[model samples]
Target chain A: MKNHVQWESSLFELIRRTSVDLPCDIEQGLRRACKTEKKSSRARWILEALLENVQKARDNDAPLCQDTGSLIFYFQVPVGFDTNALASATRLAVARATRLGYLRQNTIDSVSGSACATNVAYGAPTFYFEQCARGTVDVRLLMKGGGCENVGKQYSLPAESLGAGRDLEGVRRCVLDAVVSAQGNGCAPGILGVCIGGDRATGYECSKSQFLRKLDDKSPVKILARLEDRLLKESKVLEIGPMGLGGNTALLGLKIGSMSRVPASFFVTVSYMCWAFRRRGAVLTVRGGFKKWLY
Target chain B: MALLKPRRLEYPFTPEQVGSLRAGQFVLVSGLVYTARDRIHKYFFDGGKSPVDLKNAALYHCGPVVIRKDSDWVVRAAGPTTSIREEPYLPRIIKDHGVRVIIGKGSMGKVTEGACKAGGCVYLHAVGGAAQVLAEKVVSVKGLYFGEEFGLAEAMWVLELKDFPAIVAIDSKGHNLLRRVKSASLRMGRKLMKSSDPFIP
Candidate 1:
């Protein structure tokens, strides 16, 4: 069995990099959004400030945002790998990261509404473990903040109000409604990960997992790919702009996927991410050393 | 029209001073501000007594990132939390605490706007997700209340700020930028949806 300490160290580096660095694709998306706005617009300036903050955080090795958010680790391991040992290592890494100030102490007990200083609340640092046939392990990390999480919405389709059914067009309308409601609330010029079908909980789960995809990647399904592009454009046309100040760019990216659902339920779930899209990945060597960083 | 510069606001200000501020204008706040989140607002609205006097103070809807240094706490990153979460409690907090300004990210609701007008307060919007930039303006951590019980995010942190930057989103006159944007965006959304021009093709 691989030493748990090595896995813990790998997780620490992953958390640190995820906190400090804004991925190139997201940065590029912001740049493209910036160009579409006028020179004197608040949207433009907000993007500029965001870009500068990204650089400053990298230089200073500080937390990107005050709310480091819930640490979600997605792991793909070989069939024979020690799953329990890996889970323990991840928890230890999260605790170490919090103590080292790479992550903020953010977990809370929903019942008592009290802080769990260690950030290892019962359901927090959400883990998704997938066993693969390959020998190596792959880990992807996404830090989802509460502000954006609050704006996430799930819609039951075949609604008369939006003229939406269970089709791709229905998904289009549902996603737009979410964007409009969000306004500047979820921190505008955000990224959206949408799941077109599934039950309520799984829809949200599947939607959040889409954040692991690269910002520029299009859905493999031709129709879903087109919908992604359409949503991105419609989001820009809303004039909610950045911080709802009004401008040409309102959304940075849109990612959509579908899941088989029961006939009665046609759930479309959307997960909103603020401009600070903190996600990163790493491929680990057999000994648990970082083989390479994935953006 | 020229861009509105950030008006300087210090603590112990009058309602008229706050009333004079308009929505869409920027402001630089200096002096003492207290940090409070959803829990603390609930505490105040639930008839909890104030541990410290809050008259004419600026209340920031922020859950700051702080670390223990030697014996005291040092603020590493401090940014505004979503203000809408505290909507139900804001009006009462403004009235009961004599709060001159409510600072946070995003915008509050009609209740908050009405409260700002009636109670003589303004809502300020700090740039969301810009924690490191905002932390630079926090000169010192003056003190903390309920830190042990509420934890770092929910605690009432007394902070000394120097030229803290924010935009006036909801003014005392009931001029709410957020409200205006909502209506405008709703109209725009309808118009764009009508085109059916296949934005992607």
Candidate 2:
């Protein structure tokens, strides 16, 4: 077995490095969007400024943007592993990473109005654990910034509005409304992860889980598969183009996931992701070695 | 050729000049503008309070930003916050105060638009997240209005600015570049989607 201290140190190091730099996909997307949007002077200017900010952040080792975001950790643990020890070690790792990351202490007293710069709150480093038969642990770190998080919305559309069988059109309307309503607050040319057919809580959870999927991953389920195809087509139609400037691309991608819902309800939820979708992941072995997985 | 040179503007700007201004048109404004945000807006609107003479003045949608000495405030970083948050109360505030320009990021909704058209005012969008860059434009930090009890960051600050850069995001003519851009993009999107195999081919 590998030493827990070594594992914790490695995790902290990975978190610190990823926080200050723009992820490769985000960088590529922005560059490509900028090139395609040259005619749009406003879009080009804002995008160039954003790109400049990214470079400055990376060079200076600053948090990529002012809103460093809340930390979300996803853990995939091996079956038969000692979960208790892992949890404690993970907490220590997070606390150490928070200190070294020089991240803005965002946690504050919501009611009492006190500030906690350490980024550790009552339920911070929000953990979602999944047990698998594999003999290794996989961890994913996602810093969901507030600007994008605020635009997330969940709705239960009437079954009749979609269609007699399944109102796919209603789903389309809700998604369009959500993006249009968001305007530029969530930062335009954003990504959206949508969940269809789950109960209220699962609907929201699945919406977020879809963000974890690879940008290129194809949907596995049929309804979500169709919805994804249609929503992507219609989102650009809303004209909330890049950076909320008029452009050819309003959204980078539309990802969808679905779950069983009650016969009477058609629940659809959306989680918006800003241009800087800061996330990283790693796979950990029992031998104390790990490989960075998500970027 | 350069598109247009930046111009410095002041209060009592003519209707003709305001009409020429379009959302997304950049301008350098020099004048006295008040800094107010959520807390001050609520206090003024709800608390039955009036602090400044509102006629022909500008109300910035900002919670700028200061550090302290023994008895005074010094601005550290003052920039525009997102403007859409104040859409609920902006029209009333503009009418009540006879305010002219509402400066912030993003676009305000229909209510503010109607108020701007009716009240002969405009909405300006400062670049979001450009706090440090925008701070260079402020010539002086004038004084505070209220909410000092709240904190340095959240208080109502009265700022004296010169050559403050901004874009008219929503104008007196009801021309909103944000809305225009969205409409144009949506129309193009429908056409593109209607065509078969429209995936960047």
* Candidate 1 ranges beyond 4 A from true positions: B196-201
Off by over 4 Å in 2: A1-18, A38-40, A80-102, A108-117, A157-170, A220-230, A284-290, B1-20, B28-37, B44-81, B91-101, B114-121, B127-166, B180-201
Per-model TM-score on C-alpha atoms = 0.96, 0.75
lDDT of 1 at B144: 92
lDDT of 2 by residue, A212-294 (tens): 77665668876667677777767755656655755555677788777888888888888988776777777878644675456
Task: Evaluate every candidate with DockQ and list the scores.
Answer: 0.58, 0.21
Best by DockQ: 1
* Native-referenced TM-scores of chain A, all candidate models: 0.98, 0.89
Candidate number achieving the greatest TM-score relative to the actual structure: 1
Displacement of the residue A15 alpha carbon in candidate 2, Å: 4.4
Model 2 vs truth, CA RMSD: 5.4
Give lDDT: candidate 1, residue B12: 69
Give lDDT: candidate 1, residue A130: 94
